[model samples]
Target: MSCLLEVTALCKTYRKQHGLFRQETIKALENISFQLHAGKTLAIVGETGSGKSTLAKVLVGIEQPDQGEIRLAGKVVTMTNYRKYNHVIRYLFQDAERALNPSQKIGDMLTDVLRFSTVLDNLQRQQKVLESLQQVGLMDEHIDFYPHMFSAGQQQRIALARALILDPKLLILDEALTVLDPTLRAQIVNLLLELQQQKGLAYLLISKNLRLVRHISDHCIVMQHGQVVESGPTEQLLTQPQHAHTRKLMGMS
Candidate 1:
């Protein structure tokens, strides 16, 4: 399979205030690198502040790297790159509430996205929207409800539906299932696998949930202090983690 995305020696730094006037440059991500293949999931696991979220932001063009390069589909990524990639790369944020608009009904929000992208006609767009909702196990009636009216899991499904509406090539899930129940998480995970088989969708899954990641991801990369410490086939790395950090992370005896 061809590489859908590649990050080479990526780095991000920020200045932090330590005192009234003193400040220091803190390296958030240092020389990070990875490749995501088409129709496969690559999970990046680490504790909070391991730069996983930063990496997701970079991938979705929300943050610029101070150094290194990111290539999407054989071309280098730049600020202007998002104009094209906006249709390809979408990020499912950790917070479902943040992902949805408080003022708009769910259906209207999705309808606007379809209208703005202009990918389908009004009738076709409505059909596709309803199909996406159904895929997430939501009904047409729920589409007219406000996001706050639904449970966290239901809101998450709506978010998933919105992301899938564009038929994106790469989905960057930033702790997306954190707010969901275990059973619901399993449902979404299975849905993702089904979608991958059906649509050839690729995923960059960022999560702290080890079991779910191991089950869903074909490739795995363990990050520490903003760099990948262990990476390989998910089964190999998880079953017999060579790195001490990886072993410690999974709590293997």
Candidate 2:
């Protein structure tokens, strides 16, 4: 597979306020580097405040890093050119409800997404929308329902459909599976795997669920306090974690 996304010495920092007037800088990510290949899933595992979400935000152009560079498909990823990358990249937020509109019908929401698309005609757009919904296990009848009317898992499926509707080459899922029940999480994981196989899509999955990550990821990055303590092929890293932090994270002595 080709390298779809590359990060070189990526860094991010935030302002830390110690008191009313005192402030310091907190490093969110330090020298973080990785390459995400097409048609594979890379899982990022870390405790709270370890910068996994920050990395996802940076990749999706939601936040700018303090230093280093990111290249997507050989093009520099910048705020100015981020819109141009939308066709090839999509982000599935952890809060699917917040990501969706409450007032709009599902069909209309899908239709609105086409306002940014250049490939589909009216009929083609509707068909593509239906196809995307179907891919997520929703029926055509779901098209007329509002987001507030669906279950959490179904809402998440809608969000996934929205991301897939654009036929993105790279997807950043920031704790997307965290809110689901075990059965639903497993179902969605299977759906994502199938999609990856059929579409050759690359995924950057952020999660604290080691069990889920172990099942889904090709590679894993173990982070602690904004630093990557260990990273390797998922099986190797999970089975033979070398870092004390990684071993602790995996609950292995």
Per-residue error (Å), model 2, residue 13: 0.7
lDDT score for residue 152 of model 1: 82
lDDT of 2 by residue, 1-253 (tens): 5789999999999998898999998899999999999999999998888999999988888899989899988878888988888878899999899999999999889888976765678899889989989999999999999999999999999999999888899999999989999998888899999999999999999998999888989999998878999999999999889999888888875
The CA lDDT at 37 in model 1 is 84
Tens-digit lDDT track for model 1 on 1-253?
A: 7998998999999889988999998788999988998999999998778899899988888888999998888889887867678778988988888889999998899998888886688899889889989977899888789999988888888998998888899998999988888887888788889889998999999988889888899999999888899999999999989988788889884
Question: Which residue pairs show backbone clashes in model 1?
Answer: none
* Model 2: per-residue Cα lDDT at residue 170: 92
Name the lDDT of candidate 1: 0.88
Question: In each prediction, how many residue pairs overlap at the backbone (N, C-alpha, C within less than 3 A)?
Answer: 0, 0
